[model samples]
Target: MKRYLFCEYKKTRRKYIFVMAVAITAVALCWGLYGKYNESALKSGWMMMLYQLPLLNTIFMPLLSIVVASRFAGIETSMMKQLCSVMPKQRLYDAKLIYSLSIILLSLLIQFVSVYIAGRCFGFSGRFPIELYALYFMFTIVPAVEIYVFQFSVSMLFKNQAVPFFIGAIGEFIGLFALFLPQYPWIRNSVIWGHYGALQFVGGDWDKVTRISTFYLMDINWVMFAVSILLCVAFYFIGRTLFVRKEV
Candidate 1:
C-alpha cells in the first residue's frame, strides 16, 4: 500500500493538486469571512462561522473533490493499460483514493486553522468549543469522503474528466438550494452532496428588525452522519470492484 501510495504521490507531484486545493480552500474561507466584520457579527463570530462554514463546504468541497479526483484520474486515462500490467487495479484504486483524501484533509485542516486564527484576530466572543470544532471536522470530512468516492469512481470509469466535473457543478447547486429546504430532512440526508448542511450542528437566528444575530447549538443528525460514513464505505468497495472488473 505504501509503495502504491508513494507512486501516486510521485505521479501527481507535477499535477498541482495541492496548490489547487489550497486555492479553493482560501476562496471558500474568504467568502465565508466577507461582510462578517461588523460589531454584531464579530460578537457572535464563532457561532456565525459554525453556521456559515458548512454552507460554504457544501458549495466548495464537492467541487474541490471533483477537480482533485479528475486530475488524479486524468493522468491515467491514457496510461491505464500500462498501469494494469504493472500493479493490481484494486491497489491502484485504493492508493489514489487514499492519497487524494490526504490532500483534501490537509486542505480542510488549513481552513480550520485559518478560521481559528481569524477568530482570534477578530476577537470572536464566547469560548471556543473544542469538542464542537472536532465534531465539525468529523462531520465536514465524512461527507467529503463520500463525495470523493463518488467523484473518483466516475473519474475512473469515464475518460472524459468533464463528465464528473459537470456532475459536481450541478450537484453543488442542488446542495446549496437544498440547505434552504430544511423542512425536508430526508432530502438533505439522502443527497450526498448536501450532507455538510445536513449534519451541521449550529444554527443562527437573525433579527431583521434589530439587525441582531444569535447562534445556538442544533441537534446533531447522527443518523444522517452515520449514513454518510456508511455511504463512503459502501462506495469505496463498489468503486473498487467496478474498477477491478473494468477492462483497461
Candidate 2:
C-alpha cells in the first residue's frame, strides 16, 4: 500500500513541478516583454517593481490546485478507502501532506523567482523589504494549506477533475471581482494573497505604508496555517475511512 501511494503521489508531484516551472518561466518572460497591460507600477501608482507583477497567486494557485486536485482524485479512483485504513495513520497522513506540500511550495518558489526576474528586467523597484519578504514567506504557508485543503475536499466531494477545476475557476473569478466592490472589502479578508501587507515585512508597522499594503488577517498566519492543516488531516482520514469501508 505504501509503495502504491508513494508511486502515485510521486508521479503527480513530478508532473506538477515540471509544468509549473515551464508555466511560471513563461509568465516571467511575458512580464519582461510586455508590462502587465497598463497595470505596471510606473503607469499605475506602484512605486515598486515587484508591485508590477500581477498577484499570480490570486489566479494561478487556485487553478493549479483544481487541476492537480482533480488529477489526484482521478488517479486515485481505482483504490478504495481501504488502502488508507490498512496503512499506519502516520504514513497515510504524511503521504498526503508530502504530495500537497510539494506542489504548494514549488509553485510559490517559482512565482517568487518569476517576480524577481521580472523586477530585474523591468527595473521596477526590485527592492522588497527583507522583513516583509520574510513575513510573506511565513504567512503564505497558511494560504498554501488553505489551497490544498480546498482542493482535496472538493476532489473528494465531486470526484471529477472538471467539476472541481471549474468550481475553482468560478471561485477565483468571483474572488477577484469581489475585492473591487466597496461593500465586499470584507470578502477580501478571506483571500490568501489578500494579505499583501505581510509582504511589506521590512517596512513593518513603523511605516504606515506597510500597514496599508499587507493582507490583514483575522488570525495569525500560524494559526490559520495550523487550522487548514488540521482540516486537511481530518479530510484525509475521512476519505480513507470512506474508501476503506466501501464495498470495493
In terms of TM-score, the best-performing candidate is 1
C-alpha TM-scores of all predictions:
0.97, 0.64
Model 1, 167: alpha-carbon shift in Å?
1.8
* Top candidate when judged by lDDT against the true structure: 1
lDDT of candidate 2 over 1-248, digit per residue (tens)? 46846765565764555476457546644654464433334332222323323344454556666655666666556664655556654455356556655766776776666655645555544344455445465555555566566666667556456777777777777655653553654554555434332222221112465423322223333444555456556766675565444343
Question: What are the Cα lDDT values of the candidates?
Answer: 0.89, 0.53
Give me the overall lDDT of model 2.
0.53
